[model samples]
Every structure is written in C-alpha cells, then in structure tokens.
Target chain A: MKEFKFLIAIWKTNLQSAMEYRGAFLTQTIGMMVNNFIYFAIWIIFFDRFKDVRGWGINDMYVTFGILASSFGLVSLLFGNAFMLSDIIAKGRLDYYLSLPRPVLLHTVASRTIASGMGDFTYGLISYVASGYFTWDGLARYILAMLLAATVFVSFLIFTQSLAFWLGMMSNFSNLVLNAMLTFGIYPITLFDGYAKLILFTIIPAALMGAIPAEFIRAFTWETLAQLLLGAIGFLALAIITFNIGLRRYESGSAIQTEV
Target chain B: MKHFAKYWSIFQITLLNSLAYPGEMVGRSLMIIPFMWIFYQLWKVTFSTAGADVISGLTLRDTLWYLMLAETIELSRPPLARTMSENVKDGSIAYILNKPYDFMLYQFSAAMGETIFRALVNAIFGGLTVWWLVGAPNHPEGFIIALPAIFGAWFLQFCLNAMIGLSAFVVEDVSAFTWIYQKLAFIFGGMLIPLNFYPQWLQTFAKMLPFSSAMYGPVYLSVAPSRELFISVMTLQLAWITALTILLIIIYRRGLTQLTVNGG
Candidate 1:
C-alpha cells in the first residue's frame, strides 16, 4: 500500500511536468494517435481488396490494433522508463533508484510518463468502439484484456532491456525487440503456422500481448483465458527474475554527479 | 566539374562511416527477413482466397518481388528528417551552415551514400527471403532497369524530408511531421501494397503524388519490365524531382532567415 502511494505520487509529478509543455504534449499525443490510425488504414485497404484473410477480417484487425495500441500506450505512459532502462543500466544510473527508499524497478519505471501514450490509450478505446463489439460485458473484457496485454508488453521490454546488465550497450538490440513486437503485434496470428506459430508463442510472444488477448475479448473461453493469464504471469515473472539477477551485477559508473 | 567533386567526397565519407559497424548494419538489415516472411504468408493467403494466379495484372511471383523491392527502398532510407531536426535542436545547424559546400547537396550526397549499403543489404535479405518463398523474380533485368529510378526515388525522399526537417527551425520538433510523412509514404508510395492493387480512383490520385515516383513506379518497372512503363515512370519522377527540388531550395532559403533571427 505504501509503495502504491509512492508510485502514484511519482506519476502525478511526472504528469505535472509533462503538462508544463502542454502544446508539445498535445501534439505528441495526437501525432501518435494519428500515426497508429494510419497503420490501420493499410488494413482498410487490404480488406477492401481481398475481403478477409482466412477468418480474420477488418473487424478483427480493429480490435487487434485497439488492444495493441492501448497496451503499448499504457506501458509507455505509466512505465516510460522501461523504454530507457538499457541506457540507465549502461550509464549506471540505477544508483539513483537504489538510493531511493522505494523498490528499485517499481519506482524507477513509474517515475516518468510518455505523454503520447494518452493518445494511444484514447485511440484504442475509440478503435474498440468502432470494432462493433462494444457491450457492457465486452467493455469489461476489453479493460481486463488491456491490463493483461500491457503486463506482457512491459515484461517483454524489461526482459530485452535487462541484457544491458551483461552487455554494456544493448539499446540497439532492445530497439530491435521493440520493433519486432510492434510489427508482429498488429498482424493476425492465424496467418502464422508451424514454426512461425512456435515463435509467436515463445521467443517474441507478440501473440500473448495482442492476438490471445484480442481473442479473449471477442469471446471468452477458459482455454483462451488460461493462455492470457499464463502469458502475463509467465513474462512478468521472467522480467522480475531477470532484473533481480542483473541487479546483483550493478556497479555505479564511479563518476559522481549531482541530481537535483 | 570542380564543385561536383565536393559532393562526391561527402558521399564517399558517409559511405565509409556507414561501414564503421558492419555487424550493426547487418543486424539492422535483417529486419527485412521477417518482413518478407510475413508478406509471403499474407500474399499467399490472399492469392489462394482470390482463387487466381493473377490479381490486378500481377502474378503472386510478381507481387512478392514488387513488395520486396518496395520494402528495400522504404527500409534502407536514411533518417534525414530526424538528423536535421537534431542539428536544429542542438544548435549545430548554425555551425554546419558556415561550411563551404551547399547544404542541400551535402545532405543529399550524404543520404545517398548512407543508403547504398543499407539498400543493398536489405535487397539481398529481402530478395533471398522472397525467392525462397516464391522462386526467383520474373525478370532479373528488372534490378538493372530500376537503377536510375531507385536513385531518383531517394532524391524525391531527400527533398520532402529536408522540407520536414526545415520545419524544425520554426516548430523546434519535427517528429510529428516525420511520422505523418512516413505513413503517407507507406500508403501512397505502395510500401505495403502495390499501387496496382489500389482502387482505380485512388490509384490515379496516389500516382499523381511524388511518393508514387519515389517508391512504387521504379519498383513496378523492375517486377514487370516494359519500355513504356520505364519511359512513363522516369518522366513522372523527373517532373516531380524538378518541382520538389525547387520547392526545397525556396524552403531552405526561408529557413536560413528564420534561423538567423531566432538562433541569434
């Protein structure tokens, strides 16, 4: 409870700081929303030409994008530091988090907010509404699915960035991982088969963050719910384990600098 | 003739700098592999569903090759807008301006130099992936034929991206503009879908845009080589190049005046 309060306080301060640059914040938010919308337009074009690919159609795409966008936005907005953890680790900036009384990973990840994430979050709801699946129960499912998806997404980011503890400069690799998730998360999981299916479930787990959650939202099944829960819990556990193990190897850069 | 050598040297230096971390370059280029694999699955499913070997004057083979080349062009692009925005943000543009060479030519040369190896590597990876999925390209000569248009495509990109970068002089941040421009290229430039598959009205409108010239036109000729397509595409590319190049110059001059007043 105390840690939750601390996290909320840090988020409020970050939000206030972001609000100081209101125009830039709004521009970035709207820009991100429109950026996401434009990618969806490609699907519109694809559906227009081919009707549907297998069982997936334009509607499925809408929900898929909504879940992916919201999950991505939520992580970026709430845990923006995950995006830069590799750099923090590389520069030994973990010292700042270590010195704080709060839990290192929790406090560090929640300290910054990416303002553009608001756009993605809002746009995602709008996408879900437009998906023609908006209902009382469906809305509940959507929120639950988004939380799970965000969990998986942030865990994937932490898992990849944790490499910085062992490898000094892993930002590029982290970026590749991020890009892979973004690119694959939007596509229909049904298109993949065999080894491709194996990859989606294992290495990258884009399906966990996108398709499985999307499927759970569309029609809840015990098996699908099980998969989503397992994935979110599994990746979260993996991320925490990796970060904790890596934390043991942390060494301050040894160049003291003042932090206001 | 003497002035041409300056730009040539700028290009040469950037080319060498791009090779500085060969492993990083290869890793970056490997992105095309997944892209190609995904494209294959999508197109194969589409072709099967359509129940036809050909759709919109393209065989499945032709479409894969078209998309591979298009992605090669799209993925290999240097981040000219982002780099220029950084120059503005860091207040380094003032120093860079004092250099002897023309800024536009210098940027263009450097962009092309950086693009060469990245484009080559993407084509190789994308090519091999597509080939493995759907055999070889219908016309190997398409690559040779598409060379000039490929160069022109980069020229078109540099002009528009430079204009977006220049907006940073006023806006101080150009990421929003760059993101929109990139998405526009993806759609109208046919990076994701060939213009051949677009609705007729939309196709005609998108073709009129410079993105078609910058991306789709060149790669289209490569997939289905034709004398007429070559002539037509080259003509369109040249027309847009002249127009955009002139517009970029005007914007460049105006940006300098803005920088001088504010940067002071």
Candidate 2:
C-alpha cells in the first residue's frame, strides 16, 4: 500500500513535468495515436481481402490490438523506464535510484512517464468499443485482461533488460526483444503451431499479452483465466528474482550528475 | 571532374566507416530472420487458406521472395531524414553548408556509402531465410537484370527523404513527418502485402504513387521478370527521380535562406 502511494506521487510529478512542455507533449501523444491507428489500418486492409484466417477475423484482431496497445501503453505510461532500463544500467544510472530510501526498481521504473502511452491507451479503449463487444461485463473483462497483459509486458522487459547487469551493454538486443514482442503479439495467434507457438508463449510471452487475454475477453473460460494468471504470475516472479540477483552484481560508476 | 571525385570519396569513406562496427551491422541485419520467419508463418497460413498455389499471378514462393527483397530495401535505406534533422537541431548544418561540395550531393554520397553494406547484409539474411522457407527465387538471372532498377529505387528514396529532411530548416524536427511518410510508403509501396494481393482499384492507386517505383518495382521485377516490367518500372522510377530531384533542389535553395544556427 505504501509503495503504491509512492508510485502515485512519482507519476503525478512526471505528469507535471510533461505538462511543462505542453506543445511538444501533445504533438508526441497525438503523433503516436495516429501512427498506431495507421498500423491498425493495414490490418483492416488485410481483413478486407482474407475475411478471416483460421477463425481469427477482424473482430478478433480488434480485441487483440486493444489488449496489446492498452497493456503496452499502461506499462510505458506508469513505468516508462521499463523500455530503456538496459541503457540506464549500462550507463551506471542506477546509482541515483540506489541512493533513495524506496525500492530501487519500483522508483527507477516509475520515475518518468511517457506521454504517448496515454494516446495508446485511449486508442485501445476505442478499439475495444469498435469491436462491437460493448457490454458492462465485457468492459470489466477488458480491464482485467489489460492488467494481466501489462504484468507480462513489463515483466518480460525487465527480464530481458536484466541481462545488462552481466552483459554490460545490451540495448540493441533489448530493442530487438522489444520489437519481437510487439510484432509477434499483433498477429493472429493461430498463425503459429509447433515451435513458433512455444516460443511465443514462453520466451517472448507475447501471446500472454495479446491473444490469450483477447480470448478471455471474447468469453469467460476458466481454462483461459488460469492460463493468463499463470503466465502473468510466472513472469512476475521471474522478473523480480532475476532483477534482484543482477542487482547484487551491479557496480556503481558514482558519476556525479544533476537533474532538475 | 574534380567535383565528382569529392562526392565519390565521401561515399567511399562512409562505406568503409560502416565496416568499423561489423558486429553491430550484422546484429542489426539479424532482424530480418524473425521478420522473414514471421512472414513465412503468416503467408503459409494465408496461402493454405486461399487453397491455391497461385494467387494474383504470384505463387507462394514468389510472394516470399518478393517480401524478402522489399524488406531489404525498406530496412537498409539510410536514416537520411533523422540524420538531417539532428544536424539541423545541433546547428552542425552551418559548418556543413560552408563546405565546398553541394550539400545535397554530399549527403547523397554519404547515404549511399552507408546503404551498400547494410543492404547487402539484409538481402543475404532475408534471402537465406526465404530460401530456407521455400527455395531459390523464380529468376536467378532476373535479379541481375533487376539490379539497375534496385539502384534507381534507392535514388528515388534518397530524393523523397532529402525533401523531408529539407523541411527541418523550418520545423527543427521532422520526426512526425518522417513517421507518417514511412507508414504511407509501407501502404503504397506494398511492403507487407504485395501489390498483386490488393484489390484492383487499390493496386492501380498504389502504382501511380512514387513509393511503388521506389520499392515494389525492383522486387517485382526480380520475382516476376519481363522486358515489359523492366521498361515500365524503370521508366516510372526515372520520371519520379527527375521530378523529385528538381523539387528537392529548389527546396534546398529556399531552405538555405531560412537556416539558423541554434546557439547564435
């Protein structure tokens, strides 16, 4: 509860900082929304021709995109550092976080907010509504799915970026990993069968962030719920354990720098 | 002439400079593997669903090879707009403007220098992946025939990006414009879906756009080669190049008047 309060306070400060440059902030946010929509437009064009691929139709795509963009946006919005934690670690930027009394990872990740995430989050809600699955129950399920998806997204990133503790400079690999998750998650999960499906569910966990949650949204199934919860919990545990282990090996550059 | 050597040396130096970080270059090129693998999965299911080996004059193999080539061209192009925007932001454009060489030509040579190895590596990786998924391209000799169009495509891309970069003289940052242009190119250029797959109306619309000339034409020529295709694609490319270059040079001249140093 205390940590949650701390996170809220930090997020508020981040929002204020963004608002100081309102024009730039709004440009970035609107630009991101337009970009995401255009990307989704390609799918619209695809479905117009194919109609459906293996029972996944345009509506399924809408729900999956909703789940994905929302979760990804929430992660970036609240804990934007998840995207660049590798660069932070490599540049010895963790010293500032370590010096603070709060939890290093939480404080570090939540210290900044990416304004564009709000755009993505808004677009996601619009996507879900456009999906024609609009019901109170559907809304509840959508929010729940988004939470679980966000858990997997952030945890997967942390797990990938933790390699920086040992590897030193891993920003490139981390970016590739990030792109893989985003690219793989947006596609129809039915497109893969054997080894590829296994990799998605395990290594990248993009399916957890996209298709699985989307399925849960389509209809309540205890089996799907169990899968989503297990995947989220497993990744959460893995991220925390890996990060703490890597933390022990961290060497602070003790570089003196100032922040406004 | 002496002027030609200066730009040529600039291109040569940038090309050699790219080799300095071979690991990073190769690492970046490795992106094509996942992309091609995913393409294979998606297209395989797509083709199997269509229940046809050939759709819109392209077999599944032709489609994959076409996509491999398209991705190489898309991914390997120099970050011209971004680089120009940065130079404008940091006020390095002042120093660059003072140099004896034409600003556009200098940039063009450097961009080509940076492009050569990146494009080569991307083609190799993307080609190998597609080959593994299916087999050799439909026309091995056609790729050689297609080479001139590929270079022409790069020239078209250069002119378009150069014009976008010139906009930085006023906007100071052109990221949003670049992003939009890139997405527009993807749609019009048939980066993800081949032009053959689109409905007739959309296919006709895309063809008239310069993006097809810049990206799709060369790849299309390689996969489904013909003298008609070569002549038509090359002609379109040449026309766009001429038009865009003239417009870009005019914009550059106008932009020079507006350029302001950041620190001053």
Candidate 3:
C-alpha cells in the first residue's frame, strides 16, 4: 500500500513538472504527432506501391503499426525517465533515488514522463479506429495484447537500464540500442528470416512485441495467446534477474546524503 | 598556403581522435546492420514480383544491391552538420575564430578527416560484411565508376549541411532547423526509398534537388550507367557543391561580422 502511494506521488511530480511548461509542452505534443504521421505516411506509400508486402496488406500493416505506436507512446508517457536511467546512473545521480524512501527502480522509472507521448497515443487511437482493422472480438484480444506488450516494454527498459550498474556509463550505447529496437519493432516479423528472426525474437524481442501480438489480433487463437503470454512471462523473469544481478554491483552514493 | 597547413593539422587531429575510439566506431558500424536489413527486406518485397522491371528497370537482385550500397555509403558519411551547430552553441567557435585559419576551412577539414576515416573503415570492414552476407553489386564496374560521383555527393552534402548549421547566426534555436533538415534528408535525399519509386513528376523534381544528388544519384550511377551519364551526374554534383560552397563562405563572413558587431 505504501509503495502504491509512493508510485502515485512520483507520477504526480512528473505531471507537475510537465505542466510547468505550458507552451513548449503543447508544441512538443503537436510536433510528435506530425513526426509520427510522417512515418505512417512513408509506410502507406510503400503499401500503395506494393499491394501485398510479404502477404501483409495495408490494413494489416496499419493494425500492427497502431499497436506498436500506442505501446511505444504508453511506455514513453509513463516511463520516460526509465529510458534515461543509464544517463542518470552514469552521472552519479542515481544516488538521489537511492536516498529516497521509495524503491530506486520505481522512483527512477517515474522520475520523468514525456507529455508528447499523449499525442502519439491519440494518433494511434485515431488510426486504429479510422482503419476499421479491429473487429469486436479482436478488440478484446487487442486489449489483452496491449497489457502484455506494456509488461514486456517496461521489463525490457529495466533490463537495459540495469546495464548502467556494470557498464559504468551507457547513455550513448543505450540510445543507439533503443533507437535500433524502435526502428525494428514496427515491421512485421515474417519479413525477417533465419538468424535475424532468431535474434529479434530472443535478444531484442522486437518481433513478439507488435508483430506477433498483431497476428493474434488478426486471427485470434489459443496458440497465439499462449505464445504472447509465455514470451511476456519469460521476458519479465529475465528482466527481474538482470536487475537483481546489476543491484549486486551497485555502489551507494555519498551525494544522496546531502541531497536527502 | 600557411592557413591551409594549419587547417590540415587540425584535420589530422580530428582524424586521430576518431581513431582513438575504435570500440565506439566499431559499435556504431555494427549498429547499421539492422537498418540495412530493414531496407534490404523492404526492397526485396517490392521487387520480388516480375513487375519490378517495368517500374524501375531494376531486377530484384539489382535493386537490393543498389539499396545496400547506398545505405552503407550514407551511414559512413561524417555527421558534420550537427557537430558544427554544437560548436557554435558551446562557444567553441570563438576559439576557432581566434586562430589564424579560416573557421570554415578548419571545420571543413575536420569534417573531411572524419569522413575519410569512416570511408576507410566502411570499405575495409563494412564492405566485406555486406559482401559476405547480403552479396555484392552485380556490376563491379559500375561500383568503380560511382566513386567520383560519391565524392561529389559527399561534398555537396557537407556544404548544404554547413549552410543549415550557419542558421545559428540568426536563429536563437538552431535545433528545430537541424531536426527539419534531417527529416527532409531522410525523405528528399532518398534515404528511405529510391527516388524512382516516387511518382514520375516527383522523381524529376527530386533529381533536380541537391538532396537526391546526395543519395539517389550515386546509387543510380553505381547500378548501371553509361560513362556519359556518370560524367553528367558528376558535373551536376560539382555545380551544386560550387554554388553551396560559395554561399557558405558569404554566409560565414556576414555571420562573423554580425558576431563582432554584437560583441558575441
């Protein structure tokens, strides 16, 4: 119960900070919407030229893209600071979180949130609805898939952040890795074959996040649901293990004493 | 001549600095593989059917190889434009101005040095990896002829980027300009798709623009082009480079005068 309250407090603080910059926040939100629309436009052009790209048509692509974009937006909106934890850790600012009464992971993850992600979420919602890609039955599966996707997204972020404990500083490295994952995550997994597919499913799991879940949405089946559930559980376990391992190497900071 | 020597020395220093970070360089190089894979698959799907020949006059194999080479070359190009804007914002440009060398020449040399280092790394390692995994271009002769055109493309890109960076003289915030420039490059420069893939009228317009010259022209020249066509592309690139270079010089002179007057 206490931890729950702490989470709320952290979220409220993030919201407050975001609201502090009214004009810039609004501009950033609009800018993100424009940016995401441009990417969608590029993909639409591809679908226009090729009727069926690897057996996936325009509607199928939109569905997959919608899920990925929404999940990405949700992750960024809630856990933006988690993405930058590697940078904070490298700069020795992790000490501040450690000194807090709250769990370091929770505090760090909730420290910052991007208001612009709201724009992305809005865009995703509008695209999904306007395209008529999801039927009534598919909607239920989509929601379930989104829940699982969120879990995996947060877990993967934690796994990457934990690297800071061992690597010392990994802001640039983390940024590069995350950018690559984002770029890879939007496309259908079937496009990848052999070793590439293996790597995406296992190490990066970019395929399972959207592409596989998307398959589940298009054609709901027990087997597809099982796969997503299994993957989500496996990734969550791995993330927990990685974080704990990193904790063993973590050194507490003196700066925390002064800050607190 | 003396100023040239000074600028050359700075360029050498920049080259040495890049060489010092071998791990970072190798890591960044390895990172391009996923993007390469994405483009490779995208073109593969687009050209998998026989209809590919009708649209672009490229076989599936030909299109894939052209895209592969173009992506590798584009990735290897130095990130000069962003670096210049950063220098200006951080007041590092002041130090360059204090020196006897022309600030523009010094920055250009540094960019050239980094570009040369990156090209060497790409050729020795990146080129080999692309060949072993994705397969090399069908026409080796085309690849050879594309070299000068590629050099011209790089020069034109550098000058255009320099001009974009020069906007810092007037704009309080240059980051917005940089963001717009990069996004435009991805679209207009044919970094995302071949210019030929666009509508016929759009393709013609893109060809006339300097951005397409940076990415698409080189790829087209590499696949299959007559000697005359290759030379003509090179000449156009040279014209853009000359015009952009002259514009940059004029902008830099005026910007410096403005800075001096404002005691900046």
- How large a fraction of the reference contact set does each model reproduce? 0.52, 0.36, 0.21
- lDDT measured at residue A37 in model 1 versus the true structure, 0 to 100: 89
DockQ class, candidate 2: medium
Model 3 chain A: lowest-lDDT 10 consecutive positions: A251-260
- Interface DockQ of candidate 3: 0.37
Q: Please give the lDDT score for candidate 3.
A: 0.72
Candidate 1 iRMSD, 1 decimal: 1.0
lDDT of 2 by residue, B1-264 (tens): 986999999999999999998887888888888999998988899899999999889999999999999999988898899999999999898889889999999999999999999999999999999999999988888788899999999999999998899999988777777877888888889899998888899999999999999988999999988999999998898999899989998999999899877952
| Candidates sorted on lDDT, descending | 2, 1, 3
Model 3 agreement with the true structure over B77-179: per-residue lDDT tens digits: 6666667666666777677679876777877888877877776665555456456655766787887889888888778777877777776665423544454
The lDDT per prediction is: 0.89, 0.90, 0.72
For residues A1-260, could you state the per-residue lDDT of candidate 1 as single tens digits? 99888888988888998999999899989998898888789899989989998989999999999999999999989999999889988998888778867799987788789888988998998999999877879889999999999999899888889889999877667877888888888888879999998898779899988888889889989898888889999999999999999999988986345432
For model 3, state the Cα shift of residue A60 in Å: 2.1
Comparison by TM-score, 1 against 2, better one: 1
Please report, as a value between 0 and 1, the fraction of native contacts recovered by candidate 2: 0.36
Score residue B30 of candidate 1 by CA lDDT.
84
User: Candidates' DockQ values?
Assistant: 0.71, 0.61, 0.37
Candidate 2 regions exceeding 4 Å error are none
Q: Which 10-residue span in candidate 2 chain B carries the lowest summed lDDT?
A: B171-180
